[model samples]
Target: MRRNHTRTPLIEAIERHRSIHPISFHVPGHKNGLLVGDHPFYQGDLTELSGLDDLHDSHEAIREAEKLLGDVYGSLESHFLVNGSTVGNIAAILASCETGNIVFVQRNCHKSVLNGIRLAKAVPVFIETEWDDAGTALGIRLDAVKEAMKAFPQVKACVLTYPTYYGYTYNLKEIIDECHKHEVICIIDEAHGAHFTLGSPFPESAMEYGADMVVHSAHKMLPAMTMGSYLHIGSKRVDAHKVKEYLTMLQSSSPSYPIMASLDYARSYVGTFIKEDLDQTLEGIRELINGIERIHPQLIVQQADDPLKLIMRLEGRTGYALQELLESVGVYPELADPNQVLLILPLVKKGLSFPYTEAIGRINKALENEPMVEVIPMEGISTSRRTTPFSTLALSLEEMDGKVEALISLDDAEGEVSAGMVTPYPPGIPLLVPGERITADVIRRLNEYIVNKANIQGHHRLADHCVYVYR
Candidate 1:
């Protein structure tokens, strides 16, 4: 049977609805941009009306769009996420686990996962992923998950980050099977792997591996607006209705029409042309960077890697220095660590807006005439407990009300309990979560990130080199 790859339900509905020219009275003060005249964004801006469907209700166009979206991901059901994958993670975790239940979570999980545990009033059992020598990335280990479940049979679920920020993944099928054997549902934070469904050369998506639930930041990898994401329930073990209810509670009551429509368009776009697009883009990238002297492209050779991510190091330039060089040539990279500058690509639409040939030239010119420097893995200080304090907790810290106490520095903060999450961005995993004990090692790591100018989020008084701790 031939599939209809050209359909973009929500997008077509918006276009159809806009052509009607109806009189309006709606929640959005813009009211289809009448109040904000001549603004280009107004053309696509819309709200729930007689013809347009509501996001939370989703009986009309939105429902059809979501079905098409789900079909692309091979999910049992898929829901649009206006609040990005953060809310999707929250809703999935909340629906999967019970209050006061124990869950096995990779310590490299996003900060939002900790918040979800708090909201669900569940206890977390941290499972640390082994890191490469430089500690640049954390990879999943099937044995680790098995060992964690073996140690704590009460763990209701296990959460993992597939295709990490640096674009590498594991045998999630094996791990997912291991979780199911112990009656634990596996939830994958597949935010960075949204494009995995594009197929051929891309890693298999977590949804395809029979994960109970998977959250994807569609905007991160697809052509959708930022904050747009998709939540998929891959198995009946996850209650689809409950997940929707939690999404309603967690996401915006007034979701953006442009974001939702763009999601549908992205689903249609990628589903139709990604295989061809990837071939051209990968070849173009190879031509751009493969043969440059004194420069090494840190290509992740793992089968589960996302080839779209281009990480490279110029011999004499630090990641920061290389990043500066790239930007000077009008090529901005995604993020940089001390060792390599990362470029997540196809920044512009093909045959539409990209200066592809010009970009290749710019990149080549930048690497030219640059004197080489020694290439060595720059060791970073990201110390924290291999396992979170929750692993040893006798009770759930959900009801633990902590009073904030300010400290001058973390030098003497050993044994102090954390009042909030303190994490470095790029990979926004928490270093210290609220209600966890702050060890000297964690404190030292925080100081290291601060001195290195890594963006530290959450907690107060960070600009002063001190933070408020909970007692």
Candidate 2:
């Protein structure tokens, strides 16, 4: 079948170059697979050849391709990234703010942004999300941003995660306008919504609404090799020159040619066929939803604010338990929390249709005659008020002085502070951040999680079988 998308010029150029064998006089020792005899796609992997341009100092092919990407996204500049969205977050944070500057960030942001703040030595003003008790997930509200800005007017930048891991998206246009009114540069982590520009049935891409900068993990939702991502400078508010400097500093000297090629290929794929691919994927999803409704009748598939992500809740099983069952049946989920399992359906992939359907059928059959189990809400522990510099608290776990243990009683940890970010992994918002006081409410949830055998991390156990508290 003839593909609808235009072939990526750079990728096509490389393919055309590969068709006719060229002499080996370039940087990569592989020399068109001669050096690395068994390497895959080595013949196409050439380093800075006469015609092929350099990624960092692009002038010809790379420059042209990136320009096309910029044009496609309607950005001031777009740089193809081989280091994933983590690097883009770091680069964006570093470029936009200086040390001691305050950055208002969504509390549910990826650890990468937190690390970027730490690296930049910037003060973080966390904007807490409105937690949906029934959903057990966070939904971003514009009012929270307004409240945070009111409290921290000196915030230099506002970083938000658009379409959170569970596919919850805030109103971007309104938020962007609000940030601009305050002269705060808006940096959006569009890591999960890279294919949003291909158009609905997906939420709008951050770039569409005039964010100062947007970072996308192309590999996450598009058919690009893993770790492929892009950093888009949207408005004149962003200093593109500084962003380039930061990108150069964070990026590796020797870039992956194959990964870059895949990125270029993916851009072309989205440019040409993303609409059709998305339509087909949505149809498949509709079919899956209908099948589940017909078969299980009682299973609740949590509807996402964004359409691409599929989240479901099983009547009798925890998300972890369901995840195990899915794996046993040769199906894998993108993320699973206590109450839900998430599936990321990439428009570019075709392998998930049958297996996903079959897996749902199996789950339905297993629950056929079983009575629906009521999901019990466990009370979480709260912490006492204590203010400490993050620098003083983030001392190495080994230096903190105790063996890791779980199931600590709430009564014993009265005056102690926590040494870890204790939260559910899939959602990953810390319930008790490092150095926070541990209260009975916090202990209650930890104990319940332990009793229920939920996966836990980052704490030590004492000889008394209680969780060892950090001093």
Candidate 3:
């Protein structure tokens, strides 16, 4: 099939809609951006009109586009999402599990998954992951999920974040099979993995496997307008009708036509040119990694199952420090933590080579001239701790317990129950959740927060400040 690189059907559709000069009887007051002057998107802003189909009730144009998307992804059904992947995650959770059902979730999933649990009112059984020697956390191991299912036999579903924000991927096929054996539905948060299905050399997407439901943030990697995403239902195991109901409830009544159009355009873009672009990008990434390896032998650039996510580590400086240096050199990574910085490479913009080469050169020069120092993994005092959910934690604060105390200094927090979830944002996984008793180990870890000067949220009191607590 000969593909037209410049002609985009979605873009053409929007243009065609504008040509009709439809009257303003719809919800959007912009009236095709007539009220908002001189905006690039003015012409594309549209409401449902003749020929242009409605998002929620798709019978014409929207349905055709969605069917095309399904064909491209090889899924049972693909629903266009204008709201971010958060909506898709919530819909998937709501559709798969009943209210008050128990769900096993990876400890390090995004805040959206947590929100989904709350929205569904499902009880979450957290499955802990194995920590590396350096105390860096990875994906949930298959054995851990199996053990969790064994312990919580009634768990209705299991949620996993593939290729975590840190770029760690687990064996999805094995995990999905394990979940299926226990009659637990498998739902995946592939927000960071939107580009995985472009036939890139990266690991296969969750949808590519047998995941019952998969949520993707197309804007993360694809050339979709921001907030453009999709909710994919793989097979009959997932209740597609229930999913549709939840999606309608969660989504905006008046959807953005421009965003929807962009999603359609992005799907076509990947189908047409992604393979070539991905190959070129992978080669560039290889060259970039090799250059860094030659210059700084002591530095470690972590490789992932994903080719798009680039993680680099420096010896003398923390990942946060290195991130700042990279930003100073006009090279910004997607996200950074104490140990690593993640870069999201878009296949759409693969040909730009000088920026990457120059950034590598700067990093090499900095490593060579800078004084070498031993890279020490941050450590802290250990304290006795226990884990509890946000609901239980909140309830516990109201109930008097002599063992629990109000906020105290990190140095003095030993022998105290943690009143909140101490976690780093961007990747908002709770390190020490509320209702957990603080021990010497917890206090020691709390004190070592110099890296990134990371701010901890999800708590009322921190560092000698006490908000309300039980007894």
Lowest lDDT 10-mer window, candidate 2?
380-389
Encode model 2's per-residue lDDT on 345-432: one tens digit a residue. 6574333343546766776665555465775653311122112111123333334445343354555875577665565454445555
Instruction: List, residue by residue over 14-47, the lDDT tens digit for candidate 3.
Output: 7787777766777677766777883777667777
Model-by-model lDDT, in order? 0.76, 0.72, 0.72
TM-score of 3: 0.85
C-alpha lDDT of residue 116 in model 1: 88
Query: Which is the leading candidate under lDDT?
Result: 1
Each candidate: RMSD to true structure?
A: 3.2, 5.4, 4.3
TM-score of model 2 vs. true structure: 0.82
Per-residue lDDT for 2 in model 1? 26
Ranking by lDDT: 1, 2, 3
Find the 10 residues in a row with the least total lDDT in model 3: 380-389
